[model samples]
Target: MSDDHENQYHYTPTLWIGILFLVLFSISGILHILEALYTRLWFLLPTVVLANIGEIIGWSGRVWSSQNVFANTPFLIQICSTIIAPTPLLAANFVILGEVIRRLGQKYSRLSAKAYTFVFLACDIIALIVQAAGGGVASSADTDGKDPSSGGHIMLGGIVFQLVAISVYMLLATEFVLRYLKDRPVRPALVAAVGPRTLDTRMRLMLFGLGLSTLAIFIRSIYRVVELADGWDGRVISTERYFDWLDGGMITLATFTVNIFHPGLLLGRGNRWFGKHIDASGTSSRSGTFAEDATVVEPKRDNGPGAKV
Candidate 1:
């Protein structure tokens, strides 16, 4: 098991492809950072920005591999980066969903807002750690001139776990959406306009973006599970087209989703200051947190579209 350029990445990574993703992820990352700062959503800085960094590094490794395809270091770096890149973005999605539920319909949600954060983040962390450990193990084994199948198996297990977690999460999200629609829970009225538009439209666009991002990630996860199933040398891994579409393309779509339809548009200004009171017209002033769950309590007196306060 020499660490030569033999069949390591299966094919010479196209230089343009690597460069393209590098630029795309970089743009998304920059936009996300700017958006996070404007919205005071500091939380997104770590999650979305970190994922973008990983993708950037991974594709840079690919670009390096294009020049030196026989090198072990670049190949290992790319593989590891590509595998773990999406986990942080997935975590960001979880946070967004929790916030959406908190702002839109807390009573309709089955768990507290914090619960979704805790559970899904825990799952994402586990997947990330497992995959990272597998990469380390594989890199170590290659250095030691030992077989890397064990590490491949570990990576496959991690991907499978991720797939299961993502599926369960989607199911829960679907159930929540169903319950919300069936119950027709009253959404808190807009205390003030969200950027001169109604809250519903912004919220709807945010929801669509989240859904699109989640679906892209899920599709990528499934592809990864299959890619790593037959222990590194599988047909899936041998193909560049699959990785391009499933991995690079999917992440591109997911990352841009936030950039285009950032939740900040719906959150509006004064999102970080926790104790500010907003006076929704026709309603009493009430203190609202960044989540704005308090609006449902006091600030929004009338839930019906045309009801008198």
Candidate 2:
């Protein structure tokens, strides 16, 4: 490579993108707190927080790399975190899909919601492991030059698997939605029992938010795969500014948007929606026993004080 080309290829992390992701992750923490309170699902909160942390780390590493292109530590850290950030988001999506399936009735839906959840999460876990291992291989190598070696193969295969998983998830989700809509009668069983009504605007909005977020995340993953496809020689790494907006900023916005308009957050006040209950402390409880906890049941007949009791 020419000296001028080498100089141009010198490493520098994008500070602006790093700061943006930091702020985004910070806000994600706030949502995590709210989600914990609203859903009372303590386990979920940490996952969300962890995902945000990964994003923060990834962006911070990018910023460091911008200043010191030769810094291997930050590069390794960023690569690992970037690969893992979406895992938490996938977890969140799983919960949402599960809730939808349950509401639509287990018997009516052909595919098991729980099964889908398991499969999606399992794929994510596998992808994470592969990517993590690949990151290790890349870091331990003597030089950063692209080698069609085992490490590159691992990274490439892991990314390809991630892309496939994301695609399958989208396809399944679309199928579920289409089936749900088509099967839904003008008077659905639950609606008929409760009262006739169109789709609730609030619920619809939550669904839309989830769909949008999922699409954004899928898009971001594809970009990463392309960016890393040719190893370091790829134009994606050199065109740092484009990726800053395309991957970092867009992903941050998507993550925050989904959390803010999550089904539990938007519909929590209603005891009947999304299998949640708002406790006095402002936390949402994921207890399906909301009817038992909140409902006031009256006797069917008083019988005039038991009539000669």
Candidate 3:
């Protein structure tokens, strides 16, 4: 083992685990692509597929590093790809949040669904750019035998920004849920427009999946922050086990969990809540409000007989 190799890992990356993650991410990506195409969810397709691609490439780098731990190329590839991969997945989550808010009714949320998507997506992009740039700088410094602290600090800044954004997003999501539960009217028209009882079950499942995935990504971000803050020769960065469990395991679980509750599978097809409303002239309305021709008879507020409790 070379002296430079001492900075990374005492042993090579676990080859079996690396191979397993590569296979899993590849399979999940293919399935996501097919599902997105079938459902015509163009907005979601690229973000998720690209994220999966990053995972595939990152794991490949890990496999390469296992064979040649002293190679800067594989190490950089693994670091950059893995760190930036989950970012697009986080964007995908933001995209779906808008659709969810729209479906459930915009009145339940403080911001418009479109606004939520736009703001968060922009923030995610900023984080991605900063992190990628930092990774590049660090890799170059490592190759040239220069100090990498500046690059590490840049990466740490990006991670911290992402952490704050996700934290705010979670808070907004919680508020939306609470508001929906408390203020949503129990009108027959609203119920019919949304869907049958099964739709409710699907919505719950989607929420659960989104929550779990968000938690996983958040945990991963914290781990990255800590690892990077400790610098290259820090205890956390030198340990492969922590990387495997906190970084690889969390991301893999997140990607898989989101696949199971994909928006294409859960929100597409006969879900009236997300369906387009057509005006009398046959033009699709972009305002996302109920169509003029559609009759929405609000339930009467009757305290006399059979009033809902």
Task: Report the C-alpha displacement of residue 299, candidate 3, in angstroms.
Answer: 13
Off by over 4 Å in 3: 1-7, 184-199, 269-275, 278-285, 288-309
The per-model lDDT (C-alpha) reads 0.78, 0.64, 0.78
Q: Which model is ahead, 1 or 2, in terms of lDDT?
A: 1
Kindly give the number of clashing pairs for every candidate.
Answer: 1, 10, 0
Q: What order do candidates take by lDDT, descending?
A: 1, 3, 2
lDDT of 1 by residue, 9-85 (tens): 77889999999999999999999888888887787877999999999999999999999998888888898899999
lDDT of 3 by residue, 1-309 (tens): 123654365457878889988999999899878877777777656788889999999999999988888776787788889988999999989988877777765665667767778899999999999998998888878777777678879988999999999999999998887656555433334343332112376778888889999999999999999998988778898888899889989988888887899777776632232435556886654434332212111223224355463
lDDT per residue for candidate 2 within 144-177, as digits (tens), equals 5434245656776777898798888777777666
- Candidate 1 accuracy as lDDT: 0.78
RMSD of each: 5.8, 8.3, 5.4
lDDT of 3 at 224: 95
Q: Which runs in model 2 stand beyond 4 Å of their true positions?
A: 1-11, 142-149, 184-198, 267-309
Best by TM-score: 1
* Colliding pairs, model 1: 5-70
